[model samples]
Target: MQVTALYRHPIKSHGRECLDAVTLVTGQTIPWDRTWAVTHEASKADAAETAWVACHNFMIGTRTPALAGIWAKLDEVERRVTLTHQDLEELTFCPDDPEDVAEFLNWVAPLCPENRACPTGIVTAGTRGMTDSDYPSVSLMNVASHRAIEQAISGPLELERWRGNIWIDGAAEWEEFGWLGRDIQIGEATLRLREPIERCAHTSANPRTGQRDADTLGTLESDFGHQDFGIYAEVVNGGEIRIGDKAVLQ
Candidate 1:
């Protein structure tokens, strides 16, 4: 197999950025992936701490599908995030600045449904990323399997819907399921296939339009008999991995 793509989500439930290469660290999530999350006003997440919290405390695609329509660019040096949406003016601000945070909240509050918990501030957990899985992991996807899902639905599905960190080609459709407990080598890094990633309603939203345009869960249940679309792997040996790197079962 070969690595076809790489991605990083600087902020959870927001936007993603593509990378050509990355250095993997053992027992850690991909670099800058989910480094920040927009916490709701009533969220239990403590900004002063560095512990993982439930995803519900933040503005997420599952709760606010409109977030998918946003594109974010993180300027780490400036400690600012630039959010752009087709229907909204471009907003750039520092989440660490009180005044800027309030500005950010004001800018995005309208996009989020008031009935749901509204985002109030930004939160982070030190160096670790806030991954969906409680454990540090890198999500992997099979291009063939994604194509299978699209074929079953008789429509095109954007890969960003799944927000995988690593995408591989050359694997048979759904073949990664059998890889549980196996070790896989990609470029110079080695990872242990942990478990199949369970699916969620967030997959139903189109990343390009921020609308619930597909019944991804329904299609999965009806055709595949499960709501899983990818796998989580724990980095076992740290090394540099790049797009087009060779992937092999070890």
Candidate 2:
């Protein structure tokens, strides 16, 4: 197998950016992956309080599908994120500047219905209301797993549905399934495979159009024989990873 594709989500549940290649840094979060989120100031939900923003406290797939088509890229310096639609001009925004980030949030808020439900906003790294508990601020996936999912679905499955921070394609199909509790090398970076990522209603939500399909979960169970898919990994060593980078299972 070969590394076929790479991706990252700048804002949780907002949009995804495809990469020709990427570099993995040890102890450094993946570029633009969940670096920002929307949350609301008032809600009876378990963790609601503070300035309310849409993606901050909630998940994306269930309500917005076009989010799957959105893509992003981090400037080589890792200070700015550039947003893109499939064939549209890329819009660059700074994560460090609150004003700039807010502008971008307002720009895309209208694109999603969830944004309409509540006043939408953006939160970047170190911001008070972004991220989920246990999230390392970055996530990775194996291309092999994508292939397996595609085969099981018997159709073209878009990468945005997974919203992983990194994508590697040099391992056997579902090879990551064997990586639980192990360490693997991707390019110059070493990562510890933590555990199997559990599926949630989020998966059933189409990232491309924001429509929830009740069949997504059922399809995964019937075809893959398990509701589980993909492995979560933590960075063990910092380094740069590029497309076609050698991935060595240690």
Candidate 3:
């Protein structure tokens, strides 16, 4: 298999950024992936600790599918985030400032559904990522498997719905499931496929429209006999990875 694309999510449940190349580090997720999260007002996660908390404590595609419509761009040099959406004007702010954080909260409050918990604050991860998994891991997706799901659903689906960190082509459909507890080499990086990622309600949402238009979970369970579409891997050997890099099972 070959690496067809690379992506990073600077903030949890926010927009995705495509990359041509990136430096992977051992025991860490992709650069800046899920570095920050919008914590809900009713969350019980202690703000004082930098530990990984359940994704329910923060904004997520499952509860607020509209969040998928929000496009976020991070300026690493300035430590600022700029958010853009189809219905709202672009807003940029430094999340570190209390005043700026408040402005961001106000901007996002109206986008949330009434039944979901409202966002109260923006939180950052110090040395670790706030990824969905408790461990620092990167998500890997197989394009062939994605096509299978599309075929099963009898409709087209966007890759963004998967929110994967690495997308690979040329792999046989569902071949990744056999890779659990195995090592794969991509360019100079060696990663251990830890487990198959289970499907979630978020996958049903359309990334462009934020509408729950697809029954991704249902199709996976009924047609595929499973509720998984991707795999999570840990970077055991750090190295540079780029688009078009070959991925070989080790």
Scored by TM-score, the top model is: 3
In the range 1-250, model 3's lDDT, one tens digit per residue, is 8999898888789777788998899999998888888888777664733578878898888888888877777898897888887877799998778899899888887779998888888777754788878899999999999999999999999998999999999989999999999999998999999999987898888877777999999999999899998999999999999999999998
Q: Give per-model TM-scores.
A: 0.95, 0.74, 0.96
Question: Which lDDT value does model 2 have at 154?
Answer: 72
Q: Residue by residue across 92-189, what tens digits does model 1's lDDT show?
A: 88766889878888888767987898787888876678888888889999999999999999999999999899999998999999999999999999
* lDDT, candidate 2, 24-79, per-residue tens: 65655565566666544442233223333334255354455545556666674756
TM-score of model number 1: 0.95
Off by over 4 Å in 3: none
Better of 1 and 3 by TM-score: 3
Q: lDDT scores for all predictions?
A: 0.87, 0.61, 0.87
Error of 1 at 128 (Å): 1.5
Q: Give the residue spans of candidate 2 off by over 4 A.
A: 41-56, 76-80, 85-92, 95-102, 114-119, 127-138, 201-215
